[model samples]
Target chain A: GAGVSQSPSNKVTEKGKDVELRCDPISGHTALYWYRQSLGQGLEFLIYFQGNSAPDKSGLPSDRFSAERTGGSVSTLTIQRTQQEDSAVYLCASSLWGRNTEAFFGQGTRLTVV
Target chain B: GIQVEQSPPDLILQEGANSTLRCNFSDSVNNLQWFHQNPWGQLINLFYIPSGTKQNGRLSATTVATERYSLLYISSSQTTDSGVYFCAVDHYNNNDMRFGAGTRLTVKP
Candidate 1:
């Protein structure tokens, strides 16, 4: 992929339903990140992966929010028993192996919990 | 956790005017980036400046890592530039990349 790619660009789910968001990062990139942005809010870090291991999960808001990356290439974010307050945009980004590199973002998934 | 702060929470300017946005961090960072979120909600990377300065067309950025602050300058702004600009940073040896509240700019025609 030329850039980070996210699936289900828009999702409308009922309360208590489960939703899964996917991200396919650029080729050969080693670091991946997940973030959430509420309407008119700044990006909030959710999780970060260096390869298949998530080194930072301090930002995941609650137990219902979880994410996993496989093969060090694709990642999935799963929200269980979603709530109305969960409606927001989920963004994924990828960068090179180290902390000093630049990161690129995906188009994001807009989840609307109705 | 590192605290990131952006000044002038909101600004409105006429077309062709220039503006500067500032971002301050609570700790030294290994990576700093500027992003622009357009009206349709697309986040575009503007700069990946952790130190020194860089420019592209009408936009330029400067980050003084020693001072823990960065500045983004928009020259001859246009109506198309109306959107939210964000500054994100990753602290040294930390995997979390935190963002400031952002500076929302409105360029009037």
Candidate 2:
């Protein structure tokens, strides 16, 4: 793909329903990241996967929010029992092996929990 | 965790006007990038300048790593330039990123 790709650009779900947002990072990128942006707010770091290391999940707001990167490429963020406060634009980004390099971002998935 | 702060929470400028936005950080960082979130909610990368300066068309950015501050300059702004400008930073040894509150820009024609 020319850029990072995210599936289901927009998702609306009832409370308590589980929703999975997928991100396919750029080919061979060594690092992947997930972020959430509330309306009119800045990006909030959710999780990060770098190579085969255990992901940095410190930013996950709650136990109900979990994300995993499989085979070091495609990643999925699952929000279990979604809440209205979970409504936001979920963003995915990938970068080269270095920490200082620029990362490419996906268009993002807008998730609305009602 | 690094603290990033952007000044001028909101900005309103007329078309053809010039403006400067600033981002100040509380800690040293290895990665500093600027992004623009358009009205449609697409975040477009504006610059990846951790240090030094770079320019793209009507937009230019300068980062003074020693001072822990960065500046974004928009020259001859257009209505289409209206959007939220964000600066993200990552610590030198950590990949965990953080973003500032951002500057909301409105360029009126």
lDDT of each: 0.92, 0.93
For all candidates, state DockQ relative to the true structure.
Answer: 0.78, 0.73
Per-candidate TM equals 0.97, 0.98
Cα TM-score of candidate 1: 0.97
Chain A of candidate 2: what's the TM-score? 0.98
What does candidate 2's lDDT look like per residue over A17-42, in tens digits?
A: 99999999999998999999998888
- What does the lDDT come to for candidate 2? 0.93
Write down the RMSD of all candidates, one decimal each.
1.1, 0.9
Instruction: Quote the lDDT for A52 in model 1.
Output: 57
Query: Can you tell me the DockQ of model 1?
Result: 0.78
